[model samples]
Target: MVKHTKKAVLLTLLTVNMIVVSACSTANTSNQSSAAPTNDAKATAGATGEKVTLTYGGWKLDTITEVIKAFQASHPNIEVKAENTPYKQYFTKLETSAQGGTMPDVLLMNGPNFIKYADNGMLKDITGNIKADQLDLNNFPASLVSLYSLNGKNYGIPKDYDTIGLWYNKKLFDEKGVAYPDASWDWNKLVEAAKKLTDTSKGIYGFAAPMMNQEDYYNTILQAGGNVISDDHKKSGYDQPEAIEGLKFLTDLIQVHKVSPTLAQMTETAPADMFTSGKLAMYFDGSWAAFTINQNQDMKNNADVAVLPKGKKQGVVIHGLGNVISANTKHPKEAWEFVKFLASKEAAEIAAKQGGAIPAYKGSETAWLSAFPQYHAKAFIDMTAYASPYPVSKNTSVWNTYETDILKNAWTGEKSVADAAKELGAKMNQALAAEK
Candidate 1:
């Protein structure tokens, strides 16, 4: 899940108070913006004692700490030393270490960041170690595990998944005297809802756009029967008339519909906060926001989740976390043990209990649903019926680097949706070609 801790708490307990809990995967975030971590923080301390410390690196220090403690308690031989870095720089840091051959033993990997490490051969292929019978393969959802595999090699274990949904503010809709969205929602209904719900007098917006990949634009693109990338993961499809049409629907909400906040405004103000504060009627956010929104006092009883508005097709992006080991590691065998334990049903179960996130294991969703039953948190499971994989990219950075800035112009009135998408298609093809 999204990782944030109010403060650090150290438990000096003598023994593990095993609570039959599940292990949850944590999300790594960036704090240094574009800069790398300080030299001291990245310094490797080799073999500090008789105890074998398997250096682990992640952005989510809290989640990693918990998992490492629990694992160390059981396996006294291995001590997992976790280093937390911001998400943006983690890969950059890893790349630097990889060149110097000092990469951590265990690491966290994500899809958008995958192509770089996997393509560079910096990641260890654990497909054989994670075979169905040996690891808790049955605990994982097929869709999640498949995200980490390339050319028959598995780089990581499935951690958790997050998917997009329609988060609406009942307070805003109720005040506007408009009905909230449901299964029958269509583009027309969304437009009508936005128009009715928007009240400029109250300093409230109808919606907000953050120029995101999965939950924001891509999800809308798929709902309109358009693919961001072609099925084979080759060629860019943004130039397609269908894709442009799909995009216009969201951008139009601000440029034409005038019911949503513009790109400039959203850049200054976070959209989720605006929604939780009852400034927006609806937000296209992931199930991960269930806790973030519900925790807000203003939105606790006011917010609810629902299926996304449908276009010609029904779609939602299914994104998951994976456990990746480094190619250059001092403890390959011990790292494999950690990977196997991480891939177990028991680990996923502990995570669920700790509000870790929606477990990659199929049936483990019930605990995540239990984590926030009041917000109808089962929306993750329900949305899965219509979920689509995040459009894959072999050279992901080629597209990701240019995506936000290119799409932002369309999101504002600066570029027409069709025109901008056509230009993006050409640039995307160039990006795809550059990799070869």
Candidate 2:
């Protein structure tokens, strides 16, 4: 997701500055008043013992609506107002609301953007709130819990998690007389299978390496024994020899081996579309795709999932969404209560039954696995043992943009992999330096 920036207007020293200051104050007050619950409203709810309405801002309209209904069923005194936005626009809306002190009472937070919001004091500090409400942090994986925390302060509760996996078209494998992927398959085994599966005359390719981070190169980087950023978040690891080797492996698939679609080819057709259309044999994608894939008759009958093939070691990238309350919310008590319920096992089960992304709460995955009995859903849950948390630092979007833009040159064969990595490493380090 992209970060949103608001345009600033220049003002003169005396008259213009006075007018601009007054205008901003008036606008901010007006926005906050309209966006949040009023003091009189809260008092009325308290005095009359009536239901209190809390606005929830997030993506995933269907799943969130289901979950909210469930919450309302149990908590009759609270009503949730969902302000759904597309993933692409969610952050932009959030950034604008936050600037105006008009953010919703609660919102979904992704790992890559969590630090930016938490650091800026946009999120409520829920460390004490969680304990006071008796919410079980033990229910979530330690890795995910750590992912949403900054400097010992917890700003969010893990909602759902996802991991990368290898998705293959069984029809193509059967046609070619090849076995399906399994734990025994390694990077070399995958390449061999891709070679046998590719049939140019039929307009089918074995795989697609689209220079994507989460489902593609990030896992490869970790499996190849390379890190994206230093553990301290103080340095970039792209220039390391192991990191370059990881990147080269992907570029080789597109430019050298010819078993995967070229960057140009994937540009014309998304890898997911190609796989679903039977134009690709094998693809790498997230577990979240299972919901849509299961709904496709052809895919449900002909496709299955497996653990991502190992490189030097078995690895995959894992990321999750966190539900957080707004620091500026007028009703902290009501918001905290809602956030607490949202993190509970009951809420997670609602998400699982709807086939939303894998619920982060332990043992809740069984419900999700059962939601799609036709596919190998267990592969995603099992991958957590060897998974690496999705890489991020403060201001991840800044360096992430650099990573994607510079690496495209290598993916397109316009620059050598090593040269591109070297340039990216320098530029990324520069961005990292500016974070603090």
Candidate 3:
């Protein structure tokens, strides 16, 4: 849920010089590309006599910029300009803008980071803006929308959602004489397939066990019947027997099983890159990675997805962000109108069809699936039945950053799992206490 596709997307958008953003739009927000106009366009002022110019901050500058331009087309009186920047730096920009007292009129807030901004009184309460009275709350997925709400107040609009699944190279399975992955597959089956597929002589491995919070590690945690964060979001369960055993699976792959490359080797050659280049046979990734995998010519033809092997409970990770209007927006009404329009059923459908991410609105992903046929993306559909939101707490960012780093060190064998878990638990408990 760390937007695993982002690094892959950015890598392509910057290095490959492809991943062309074909601007497409409806009567409302779209990805249509056009030159920004210097002149202000406005429709007749609704209740206020003033025309307004709105600014937005989002990592998807190209996509959002197009939507804003088209927004001006429909509401000719309101002009919206967006500053697009790299996803890695968008939060720093948001914080800097917040400090300057001029944060964008509409700010982007992901699930994990939203609690910090909303709880600190940096956001406007938009519960009234999005009324179950006006719109059907049923259109959006429950888990995704709930992630943006805290204590009955909605601070962000759920834009898109994605879940994790196992991506396999079909060619590898064929060469190894192993059956394709399916729901019947379990942990032992996966470990056995991994062993059969791994061949150091051929320089191919079965899995990539990078210690990321989401893709590999979180799935492992859930598979071991453990929660990454406690229900109350206080203290650390990182040291729990199940959680440590979950993490040990990865270390087992490298140190005990000798299938995956050591953590050092994985660091030098990132897992995503390795999987895309055919060096690895399988990977756990989000639906968004379809864009990157499909765009990569080498693996594009051979890649496919399957439901991940089950643990005590079948699990998948869901993640997305909500559209939030600034607490101090001069045109709060217009901003809300725009937010509703972007989050509307039509808008979500267009977003799904556009090939960027899956829309959280009900029934939108059907179109997204049709748009890409070769991958047989239904594993994602199957995942929705049991998917869980990425866990977040008051100080989620603080705790996870430390916990994941220590876990990574543990995976690489720099420290023992027991020792690392205790250290991680102590730091996480301290972070949670400070949040309290």
TM-scores, all candidates, are 0.83, 0.87, 0.85
The TM-score, computed over Cα atoms with residue i paired to residue i, of candidate 3 is 0.85
Instruction: Write the number of the candidate with greater lDDT, choosing between 1 and 3.
Output: 3
The true-versus-predicted C-alpha distance at residue 48 of model 3, in Å, is 3.0
lDDT tens digits by residue: candidate 2, 192-279: 9999999999999988888888878888888899989887677998999878988888888888889888888898899999999999
Q: Write the per-residue lDDT of candidate 3 for residues 150-188, one digit (tens) a residue.
A: 888888778877778889999999998998898898877
**Count of clashing pairs, candidate 2:** 0
Model 3: lDDT equals 0.71
The lDDT of model 1 is 0.70
Q: Give model 2's TM-score versus the native structure.
A: 0.87
**TM-score of candidate 1 to 2 decimals:** 0.83
Q: Which candidate is the best by TM-score?
A: 2
